[model samples]
Each structure stands twice: as structure tokens, then as C-alpha cells.
Target: MSTLTDRLIYIVGPLKLQNALMASFLERETGAKCLAVEKFHDIQNMDNENTGQPKLALWDCLGNDMESCLSEFEPDFKEVLNHSAVAFFNVSPDLGIEAEFIARGVQGFFYEHDRIERFPQGICAIFNGELWFSRKIMNEAMKKDKKQTGLQTRYETDLSHREIEILAMIAGGASNKMIAEKLYISPHTVKTHLYNIFKKINVTNRLQAALWAAKNLS
Candidate 1:
């Protein structure tokens, strides 16, 4: 397994002091260079000394209003995911939102209630190509898989070839306009297909439909 020294780690948060403090701690713990980034976009600005080094971002999701924080964070998600293996820190311990983040391609999570000592090991684990979800979440996911095995097959079978193609594009973070252009179809036609895809898969939005495609299509 590769050590964290082979990559760069960014501690991203709204608060500069917090980001810096976390970055310092990680540097000491992992013997790897860590950077403090107040904004996710800031990661793009900094030039990487080693272009081949893997990048990991520990995003601080701690706030009284998590909904607002998350909503604000979503827009930059695709961009950041393209450049880094992103993980959430200072998250609520409930594990209720783990599935949503997983669908959005987050690499791992560290709850606020988690012991500080555990952070290094968890971060190391993530760098070792392991996901850092709670055991409870893993068990729940396993249960869901078993229960939905037949339903997933049905959903897969019900999708048209074009719809399947569109779903795959959606999972790849393509917008409706992009998909339409690539497929040589109108945006309105794309919307119609999306509506049908959502209905057939029992999802209400593009995110859910994308997640469904990720699990069921491939």
C-alpha cells in the first residue's frame, strides 16, 4: 500500500484557522505535506509540486446548519471530485446522510464525534484505497442490496437502450445539455427521457437517477 507521503492532502473549510490547524495536525501525524485551503476552488489555484501525487481533500462539513452548508457545497462537488479524493469531516454521527454522499462520489467521512486519534488511521485507510464508512452503514447497505436485488434487475430491464446510455452519462456528471448534444437530441427530448427514467427507477431527481444507474446499470 502506498503511504500518504506519496500525495498531497488539503484541509478545506470555511474557517482559515481551522483549516490550518487541521492541516498542521495531519502533517505531523502522517509525515506528509498538508495544505490549508479555505475554499475548495482554491485547491485548483495552487500549483502541485509533484503532478503525479494523488490529492485528498478533507472538507469540513461542521456547522449548525448542515443543510445550507451542504447545498452551498454541492455546486463545486463535480469540479473538486475531478481533482481530488474528497472526504467529509466533522459530520454528524447519525450516518443518515452517508448514502447521499456516497452517491455523489465522496471517498470517506469522519464524524464530529469521532475521536481525534482515529483521524490519521482513517485518512491512511482512505489513501490505501479503502472507504471509511461506519460498520452500521456498511451493514445497512448490504441489507439494502439483498432486498433490492430483484427490484434492481427489474429496473435495469425496464430502461430503454437510449435511457441507459443517458443514465450512464448522468453518472459521469454530464448535464442534460451535454447529453443532448452528444446524443444528437433536443434538450426537451432529453428531459422526457429523464422523466421516464426517474419514473421507471422510482427516483425523483437526477441525483437519485444517477445513483440508481451507478448501482444497477453497471
Candidate 2:
């Protein structure tokens, strides 16, 4: 396995708003176990003397009083950021405000006003090594160059048809080879598809993915 797969991800911000949402989403949505610290210094201090470091640190970029927070946090911020892939969340509009955070240290910025649907999409994108910007902002950036795009419906990105079938087979006690034969594909293909399905549904194993499919999709 790669070091990234073994590494944890940390989220730092206020307890109630920015940090909690990301912490909950990461724990449930990704394979990594995430640790959340309220302060940047606490996270840096913990990592310095620890056995290993987190894969990434997602900081709430623009907090109460940006100038004051930056002046107070510059030192610890640089240290924590140096260890992990740093991402920022603005949560409010005003691209200028988000830009300021990006300039400070964040590699990516997520809008706070996006529907909860986009939050996971953004995190997953960042986890895979890409920047997640507000499609709203993107729309503005590309407006003159592009044509109209259809708005994505809520259920559109949920699951694939084959994934649903595999999940059902899993719930029905079908082994990988059995699923392979049933689907007229090789066992290797079945395993690969299963892994992708698990990633989509945010589960690590067949049973959990199956249960989620049964309860939510079926």
C-alpha cells in the first residue's frame, strides 16, 4: 500500500461549523481515519513528536477577523502546512475573500454555501489530488467560452447500475467468483469493479456496501 493510504487526514477550524462537517464527512466517506483539532498549533505540536504525520490538513481559511487570525497564526500555520496537503474552506461567497486564503497557504478552496452534496465531491476531489472550486465560480470563469450545461440532479451521481447489481449479489451471499460468472466477466474484473463500487458508496467491504445499497438505493 502507498504511504498516503496509511496516513490520516486532519481538519482544523471551529468546533461547531467548518471543521465538524468535514470531519464527519471524511470519516464516513473516505478510507482514512481523520483527527480534528480546534487550533492549528495543537495539530502542529501533536505531529512533531508523533510516530507519523497526517496525509493532509484542511484549514478553515477565512475565519473571524482574517487579518488578526493570520497575524496570530502565521507561524504554526506554516509548520502544519509544510507537513500535509493544505486545503481551505471559505464557506461564504466573495471570491476575493477565498482568494486571500489561497494566497496564504491553501492549495484548494471550497465554498461554504454549496449544497451538502458538493462537500463530499470536493473532498473526494482533493483526496485524489485536484482542486475543488465552486462550480458557481467556475461557471463565471468559463462563461464566455462554454455553452449551457445541465444542472446535476441530486440522484445523478449516486451509484452505477452495475454497482447496484453487485451490491445486491453481495447481500444475497454471492462470492466474487460467483458474481464474475453471473456478470459474464472475470473474477479480477469483479474485484476491481467492487472496489470502485465501495469507493462510490463509501464502504470498505462487500457487506457494508451491500447494506448501504439495500437501505438507500434499493
Candidate 3:
């Protein structure tokens, strides 16, 4: 897991704008091969193949397609996902989402915007299996909308303000239960709200829903 040499960092997500700038920055900086797939379905399908999972797989929790890829498969990547070192990044990930992912198995979690300048360095550090956020000072970042675009803009003309709010929270890494609690509404309302967000975002699951926002929101 010494990431000093050229190695693959399996990338997934909408590969949205927030991190793309940083991803490119890292690619140029690290001399690494960042392999990406539109969805993790390809890897899931090739689960039995001998491609050998990378020494490090950098994933975004916001991909709904990956969620489906996970749900639909039995020998889920979760089994082999951590056989090697794993580092996770979230564009607007909050505690709840980060906790969920940690439960699923991740050594670290980072926010895209905050780490923009540090991604290149961070990935190498994380690849070594260190639980990285910071040695001191754990962090999180949330910005009010100033017309920033990730996957959210894809729905700008289609979604309502309430739906937009729910999407923001979801993208920021809130669960349906947490979203309901935060929005002061019933879980049923949260589901309804999320359903609308999903439709507008054109994704089937929350991860994808979040990824949509991550890629387009800003």
C-alpha cells in the first residue's frame, strides 16, 4: 500500500466537478492511473474475474448506481472491497453518512472542496491504511447555494425548492430518517420528498441521488 509509485486509484462517482479539478490535480501530481467507470456495475459484474482489485479503491458514497450494483449482487464487493486498503471521499458528506460508510468499512472519509488542494497528498497517505481526516482537527464544509452546479443543475428546471432542500441535505450525506428528523416532518414525507429528488435527479437510489448533487451542485 505504499503509494509512492504509479498505481491505480479506482475512481467512481459522477466524477463531478467538485473533485474533478482536484482529481486532475492529483493525477498530474502523483503520476497515478485513475481508472473510472460510469457505474460500479462493471466491476460488480467482473467480481469473479482476475483483474485484481486495486491496492486502493477511492470511492464516492454518492453513487446510486453503485448502490444498486451492490444491492443486486450477492458476492457484494463489500467482501473484497477491504481486502486491500480503502479510502472514501464524500463531496458534502456529513457525520451520518460518514458513519454509515465507516460501518460498511472505510479507513477514511474526506470532503472534496476542503481537500481540493490536498487530494494528491491525501490519497497517498490514505492508501497506506491510515484513518485520515486530520491528525488534529476533524473537518466538514457546507456552503449555501450561490448557483453552484454539480448534478443539481440537471434538475434545476425540474425540481421544486423543497425537493431541492431535501436534495441538498441528501447530498450533504443525510439519511432518510435523519432528513425527516431535520426537516421536522414524518419519515413518509422524507421518502416522498426523496422520491421527487430521485426523479428529478434521474437516479434510483440515495447514493446516486447524492452523487448527482455532488457532481452538479457545485
Using TM-score as the measure, which candidate wins? Answer: 1
Top model by lDDT, which number?
Answer: 1
The reply for model 2, stretches above 4 Å from the true place, is: 1-5, 16-21, 49-54, 61-65, 134-218
Winner on lDDT between 1 and 2 is 1
For residues 1-218, could you state the per-residue lDDT of candidate 1 as single tens digits? Answer: 22467778988877888778778888878877898877787777773544667778888877635476567578777777766778889888754666556656676789888887788887886665446775456445434544655454535357889999998887665667788899999988998998888888886555456557656765
Report how far off residue 103 is in candidate 1 (Å): 0.8
- lDDT (tens digit, per residue) of candidate 2 on 1-218: 11234557777776656566666666666656677887778776668655464466766655545566466458687677557667666555643544444334454566666565565565655554344554343333333222232332333346678877877776555667678899999988887888788788676444345435444543
C-alpha positional error of residue 217 in candidate 1 after TM-score superposition, expressed in Å: 11
lDDT of each: 0.73, 0.59, 0.54
Task: Give the residue spans of candidate 1 off by over 4 A.
Answer: 1-3, 47-50, 64-66, 139-150, 154-218
Of 2 and 3, the candidate ahead on TM-score is: 2
Itemize residue pairs with steric clashes in candidate 1.
none
lDDT of 3 by residue, 80-188 (tens): 4634445566645433444334334454556745546556666775553234543221112222222232223343547887887887776665556677888799988
